[model samples]
Target: MSNNLFKDLVSSVEQAGVEVNHEALQVAKDKLAMKSIIIRVISILGSLLGLGLFIGFIALAASDIFQEAIAFILMGVLFLGGAFALNRSNDGAITVSIAVSLYIIGYAFLSYGLSNDGHLMGYSMFVIALITLFLYNNHIISFLSSLSILVAIHFIMFDLDIQTFYYIYLAIVLAATTYLFWQEQRLRTMDNLIGHRYLPIFAALFTYTLVTGIISSTQQFGYYYFSEFRGVRLFFITVLVAALLFTVHLVLDKMKVSKLPIQIATYLLVIIFNVLVAYYYPAFGIACLFILWGFMRQFKAGFAVGIATLVWAMGMFYYDLGVSLLAKSISLMIVGAMFLAIYYLIQKKGEKHDNI
Candidate 1:
């Protein structure tokens, strides 16, 4: 087995009391490494090209069926069934690539077929996503299906105009995602399939939750025009803020921050940032949420995402600010100064931990 995989196996065995079959792991890794990484990547890319061509041919051949919703539904079911069957023996990256294309195309067909019936489409998506989670164990499929479920709920609630319930749903998602990430070890080592699929699901949850925060912050800043449910959107954003604070609590605990005064001060700065972001800096609160979670988890990719989000949020703040250039500069300077001060404090705390 490769070094990282070997280490992961060791951690799983030690921390979670999971059994590791060393001989089987080595055989599996050797099989996977039979081809060079570049060849596997090229094969997947070539498969994508083939799938695209196939889709194009199907589109042209079935042009007449596009007008009939029933035809679309039938074709969608057929495609989904094909993908599921293909994935039953899905081994290579090339096979997975093709199956994934078919799966997405299946959903696209269903979406178009049920375009006019928003409620029906939402329900179908939810059911299908749940079914796909069980029937298709691929990481990409799980991630996409999880996102579909979220989008389906939002669509259903939006269609019904249940503003309050929609926000409640978002809160529930936030809570669930928080719990999932907190219990990552258990989930990732529960069993074979669960272990294989945990990361993608967590990734989907984190991504959707963070992106929602970004959009909500933008809407609050008058970037997106909401016809109604403005207050409810604010409530949703508040839930994100609460999630951020919860992540901050986790990070402080991780850093062994025991001083009550320091904790209180850190939270105070977060609140101040929240207030400022509510008024001027779009997505800043969400960016900080990313940063805190990245710190808590020591996830470098999430950290990179947080940095990118912070930069984008600042750009949006400047571009969307209607005030004079001088005013914009002043506002940005204040945000920058506060951001740096908080970062410095966090850095110092981290250094203190390392010294200990």
Candidate 2:
């Protein structure tokens, strides 16, 4: 009986060894496949770049026969056509890069030819973006295309009053994006497979929101167009938007945890804290909302982007504050300490959760 048991144990160990070896072999194969794919992608990018540069040089040399803008537009058309053909052939990386390059060239030509008026460019890019979204469903292409459309619209409407037209446009974008974000979350809660597909779109919109919000708030990038309230009203509107975003987050939190009493108490605390932050450090408040949204949605890119923007906003705030350098330094130190404490708390909580 003892001999039989020993033989069975040895057999089991041998079987486990085989399985482990199989897994390791599979992992190696996967790594090799990934390496090949990366090599191919790099080759494609280099080829495309070389081709683009050659065409650009030819265009420059032939500038007498064809105007610079016309030459660029022609090159853009050729690239766009090539992108469509490559996409049809299922070459994603190169296809998307070509599309992006085409957009860059087209935008440059349009900017130069149209005397900086962006209405035509904006509409053209938006149409192209929609077509690409439907045709390829590529995430990076969609993001850049959407970003171009938004920027073009901004340039097109640069002369509008900030209080009325700009604020209304922003609110519409905010409301639509929030609805899309929540709807995706809701579908995910219901375990719908399609819900995962649109998450990228929402993530892109979050990026767009962060970028446009920051630019408007800081008056960066030569954004001098404003209404009667000018800077004051723009800041107020931003704070209001932040409050609204926080409110949406609160609702999402309640949906997740469903603890009414805790939610109410938390809300009260947030209201008090938010008012002070909104008044004194409005950009920081908006950044916090972005961070919250990113974490809640499990969007790592958004989280990283929010952290970057938060740092920028903080630095800008410190620079612009009308206070003594010593006081400013002290305030920064206090904020740094608070961040450390928060980081420590988060680490502890994560460790506890992991143990559980």
Candidate 3:
């Protein structure tokens, strides 16, 4: 269908007196569609290896100059400059691979230089990532830098033993996740630096969101460090549920769900029900958010993830209860049936929409 759509688009343009070299376009597409995922993974591993080697070399330098904070900062800046220059060279994979290594190593030096101060280290890394977004435009580097920003934020909160602003951080993540996916096309088509970096940022945001969701569910770092703010968990659930609802609204609008009065009534009912469900099982709501995105974008991976997350969260929820096995079995059956019914309705709606 997508191939057909592309051909139809080219045909329409040709009819409008536009010249399109489809043979050349097909060649380019074929080249781009090569199996690059494994290559990318290897490239990333190579960069990490390079970073490790650089650290080891720096440690064994055995020079007082190497021990100074300014020395590390200078080295980081130098490496970052090299990376930026390499990126601008229109080089092939080898050059970009080397640039990625240098970029990681550069940030490592910066981190070590500011190791004495947590706030300085985290904020400086964030600033460096921001600068890199404008200077280096490669996919791997952009993704790594976006991840660096998230690492910086968490490092500040966790390293400094301050969990007060966890809710604020959560809010930022949710808001960014919603906005990035919602405005994806606009950002991708932009005629500036942002367009080049949007996909990387979008991917990074989802990676961050899913990782944090796991951490939250597992009662791990977020739980250990921020347990004192247990009350704020409710705030998290509220905010997340709101995000889910807002996203649903956007999706329903696109689906042309119903007339205004009917849509408003449906929204009210959903809110009422979700409020109760979220209070007891917030992870379920989180999973539903992913499911919504999965459906909206025809994203099979995200949809699978959402379903897996849903099963895991519900299993946990049931595990936590002290109810009898019979009660649990019944409960699972009920929810499972409800989900199937909803899925059936959605499938019917999709078929109808397609026919229309």
- State TM-scores per candidate: 0.75, 0.63, 0.75
Worst 10 residues of 2 by lDDT: 188-197
Q: Deviation in angstroms for 28 in model 2?
A: 20
Candidate numbers, best TM-score first, in rank order: 3, 1, 2
lDDT for each residue of candidate 1 in 1-356, tens digit (9 for 90 to 100): 33455567687786887777654664465455544546655665676587668867977998876678888788788888888887766556677677777788787786667665655778878888888887886666888888988888877876776644555565577777877877776665576655666666777878887676567546353443243556665665677677777877877776677799978877776776665554344357657766777767667778889788888777776776465787667656666765775577579786888999
lDDT of 2 at 36: 61
> Candidate 1 versus the native: TM-score?
0.75
lDDT of each: 0.70, 0.55, 0.71
For residues 1-356, what per-residue lDDT tens digits would candidate 3 score against the true structure?
24456669989999999999754675465356345656756876787797788667867886777878998998888888988888877546667777888888888887778666655888788888887877776787888888888878887787677666565576578778888888876776577875667767877888887766656655334355354565666677667767877876876676667567756755554555455444445556667788888988878888899889888867765775445677566556655654663475488677988999
Better of 1 and 2 by lDDT: 1
Each model's total of backbone clashes? 0, 0, 0
Task: Give the local distance difference test score of model 3.
Answer: 0.71
For candidate 2, report its TM-score: 0.63
lDDT of each residue in 1-356, candidate 2, tens digit only: 23245447657978787433433443354355455656545655776587678766976787674554555456556655655565455534555555545544544444444433444665555565555555544444555555666665665565342333565565555666767765653554353323423544655666666666676656354145344545554555555555554654564453453556745544544454445333344455556566656666565666677688778866875776554687556556544653553364357557768999
After superposition, candidate 1 runs with Cα above 4 Å error: 1-49, 114-119, 162-168, 190-196, 219-234, 279-282, 322-338, 341-356
